[model samples]
Target chain A: MDNTNEKLGVGLLYNASLPEYLEHNIEQVDYIEIIPDMFWSDEGRNAYPRFVDLPQWRHQLNWMAKQVPLVAHNIGMSLGTLNYFDKGYIQFMKEMNESYRFRWHSDHLSFIKLPTKGPHDHNAGIAIPVPYDKDYLAMLREKISFITEQIELPFLIENNVYFVEYPDQDYSETDFINQLVSTNDQANILLDIHNLYANSVNHKLKARQYIDELRMDKVVEMHIAGGNEMGGMYMDSHAGPCPDEVWELLDYAVSKAPNLRGITFEFHESYFPLLRFDGLNKQIEMAKAIWNKYTLQPYYHELA
Target chain B: MNSPDFQLAFATLIASPQLCKQAIADEPSVFDQFALTEKEKTRLRSVLRQKGMSICCSLYRMNRITPLYTQLTQTATLLGDELITLAEEFWESYPDSSLQFKEEVLAFGQFLLAKLEVGTLKFPYLQEILRLELAINELSYTPAIIEKTVHFDYDIVAILLAMDRGTLQTERLQKVQVAYKVYLEEQTLKLALL
Candidate 1:
């Protein structure tokens, strides 16, 4: 297969543990996705705007940014929070984007911070699932709009792997995602196939039906990663190579998503030995073969 | 108005397992301080009674535990038998887990130090190990960490070498009058013992 699909490209998420793999196969992948939080240390904060010290990662990251196509995937946006918008976080993102010039920015749909004024105003410290209600849609839409205006980039939200049950008034999870993106054309989706699969299996929902329900036309990028079972619940762990189920979803997504631009693989640093050393090249080969099938066969009537 | 309150309440409950236990029981005043509406209170009641407990506890604890494990490896090792229980105790002591890695680690280290200062924690190597770990964390991933040349206040190397592996002795370490410089060079921590 060729290096990239003219329409869609394959990429690796930049995990620090796999420098050898990244360097060895630099030409193989077309782009690199990076998490912004790793580049800086948080100083103390009191007011709305918090200052961070970034002298450490400046030179190294700048050098990496020049190497491949850098796309922004932030974990700290806390978009579902009811109280705070994290304007400081936005400012930091803007500054980083200015330096790296990322193609597009995306964050998870989960709420990492509880924004209300109370004792525990600190971030929830993990991507906590948000309620899938139409009532909450207005809030998330406004937040997305605010983020869009502030970042001035084509923004997207990845589907969250939710475990909890929240009271929903109207919309199911897919309904919520579909309506959210359909409201604005520019707003897109980074359909994390692993997350979708994990959530479906964990919650006893049909995985294929979930994919069928998604507004695939809105999907711009897709994520493939591995997970593990913990406490009888499946996690979007990113701990190993792509599971067969996720690969199948990737094929389905590639066939369905007309506007898809990227396919990225993710794994935590702890699994570098297993995934990077053993399975990375094979994963890339499989992804390339599928990318051939995906981009080769026409998905859109106009293109055909 | 209610959603914000509900979020805050749920976060608080997750952070405080004791309060969650109380809220789960048939206690009306357990959630009095929380700013929850009637509907929100009903939902909280449902969560406590019927669903979401497993993930709620796992998510809350895992988030807090990640940095703790990463930062305080030696201290965690030192408290081998008491690690799990003490971790929970430390978390309960400082309930609000911060995303700031340094602050959270430092605070937990200090909490252990306080436990050592009192008769609460009886681990002999806790103090030096925690201090050394904290310094390493502060220095970060750089190749070298430099500090102003000064006479050593703590003789960490001797305490480490002389201390028996058995019993994890409780005798207070005598601060040896030695001058030394500690820094990382060539990815190794070098101590200039004088």
Candidate 2:
């Protein structure tokens, strides 16, 4: 969804370690994408004022909001969750948008929270991939429609990294995404290049071919990350700095995605030592180098 | 047949590799609770057969324990190898996690306390470590200015430092009973010996 055609330029997914990095190298960051769930502790489904702000995290966010454009990359929505949609979460995001003025928001096209009859829902602890079937597509469309209605900003759906694939599915991942984005002009894609790489290595599929099949124009943002091999499979660990192959794929993806607004580099906070400030700056520089080649001149470099 | 049923089954399998094994063994009763279609059952059964299923379970375990280890570092360190068995037992008993960091950390702390009280899990200084970590965690999340005193039968600060340095000598540790104050100062958790 093109809420604003203005490009977001290079972005970094905010993690626990970025506070130190941002202290000295804030200039290197064009934008900061925050996972909002990290900034608060939800007491439960039944607590009064359920969302309690983490003072330290909020203090950091409040400062960052003034320095650069802040976009939200949420993990809590679990939008692909079947038979249940978290309207309260969407409402909270609306409140967050009011506070941070997020240019756009996105979440994975997977389910993490499994609702039950208990006092609290069960968290799957990992993003479980949604089956690419018509029923799921319909469910996602309804949920996205509800979200966009509640929050007018552009909403992007990130592709999932699957360790195992369902045997029979209605559509390919690309086909499912294309169909989902067709729901409305406000719905779009956040393509993750490393997820494609992990899937390619594990499932022995062509990453470029998957990209080729995707509707590139719907790709409003792209995620570049690194992964590690685990249990005889390439896992999308987001370990640290992007691999050479992912940068190459990002180069290809940027070339094809004419409407791309942002390129986010993600790494887990625990790997901060592996990606010291220098490593982070290099990733940003490389993404900007690719972004500069394909995007128009002088995009939204900072919040004005 | 339905997505929720499939999701619940998948989530159950992730949380319990025992059930994943049961499903892999083609034990029909493993998924009897879910009203799944024959195709759904077959797909889940096939998924359990894949090597990636092990990865899935392992990843789930890693994620599940992250908040615990990150928030309760000293307690986790003290538990060491015993954490694996204790965590599995805790999950088996208290299967649902709110996924809230505060909730998970606190829940695990309470679970350990219950185990210690029941004499199932034992350690000389486990209670002090768990209680100290729990207090710090609670203070970190407490928005209002609050203070609480936690009493330790041993020198916890030295023990935690030794634990961090990997030089803890349980027998040589000081047996001084001390009270440490945990409170929030300037939005950060602070600890002081009183």
Candidate 3:
């Protein structure tokens, strides 16, 4: 749905290498979300090999920013951890933000580490779902505040796909998220559609109803992807195209997300072939058709 | 052929519906091999005989079949050496043999190589397949012949066979093999330069 006043943007997370992705596909979409870790190199603190140096990355990012608004979707910033935030990572992210001049940055509202004295478990540096409890909420607010203060850009927190059941959770996922957003006024929410879909499928909840209850005003961006059904659980596998159900949810989300700045299409290289440009073209066409059917005004910037 | 350990190990490996589909796809008779215990075999067979191969096939298809392929390659590599050594000695003794005789010998070599590669003629399970392939190549023919004709080496060939049979395990290996196969396919494009 192309709303002239609202920022209706189509995004691909970290698909910069594929020429067709940038030249062919992204041309049709609006705004691209780059995972800074993918481009980071060993040279400088946040040196990304893809960009070579800060100056080069700046030029490329600026160029992309000029084409359409650029947003940084980070995977490394473990927001829900009990441990202190990585100062090196924070500094690097700040530097990249300054260099790229991103619209806004967001990370998963999950823990990637535990407070330990020895070397951190670098291997398990994956975004893990946090227990939906008040204790966690208190810790999370402090972390979000610290991040927002360091980086002037609006810090957005994303909902994660939790596999294991939480026994000690004091509130529902929605309540926890709503509380976090309310406490941290500057913080926005990155509504990952697939994670929502997965949680609903696994936990047996209505996906739309969950979206209906979401604090949509705080949502700065949205993530959509495909999932794999395993052990009766729908794992968020970004290997294939988004299913019809997820698309329907996105349509519902668009109406709900009043302050939604952008919508990101998350796909990983491992499952890139399943999308096959032709198949992806059809999906994009479907998305466009849906957008056209819903929104009354078709803005030129919406296409950009 | 029917042993408790073999049945237990094989049954455990193919316990998952996805794993059973892959095992059956690779070797249709693999299910029959487990016929020693009808109860266990029937349970495994029912999973495979389901209406939709969606869940099992998708899981198998998504996972990289490289480790299984690697295991097959290792077997072939070792067998290739034995076959080459035997063939060379036979050929050297009877250098002026007829075409029929030559064909017979070559057929025997291929058969032995195939059987060994399939993990039937086993000693080194999966880990030593590569080393055995190299050893066989070294023992079997001249370096020039191997360098010029053996583009895949024993390890690569074994992997390809395992992939074809759908017996490969481990997702990471499958991803690597898929990329490697794509790389192999791209080599044909390079031939245009010639």
- Number of colliding residue pairs in each model: 0, 1, 11
Q: What is the TM-score of chain A alone in each candidate?
A: 0.90, 0.95, 0.84
Greater lDDT among 1 and 3 belongs to: 1
Q: Write the per-residue lDDT of candidate 1 for residues A100-125, one digit (tens) a residue.
A: 77777899887777643432247675
In model 2, where do residues sit more than 4 Å from their true spots?
A: A1-3, A297-304, B161-167, B172-177, B186-189
lDDT of 3 by residue, A199-240 (tens): 788767778878877788788788888888776667787867
The TM-score obtained by chain A of candidate 2 when compared with the true chain A? 0.95
Error of 2 at A66 (Å): 0.6
TM-score of 3: 0.57
Evaluated against the true structure, the overall lDDT of model 1 is: 0.73
True contacts kept of each: 0.40, 0.72, 0.01
Alpha carbon lDDT of each predicted model: 0.73, 0.86, 0.57
TM-score of 2: 0.95
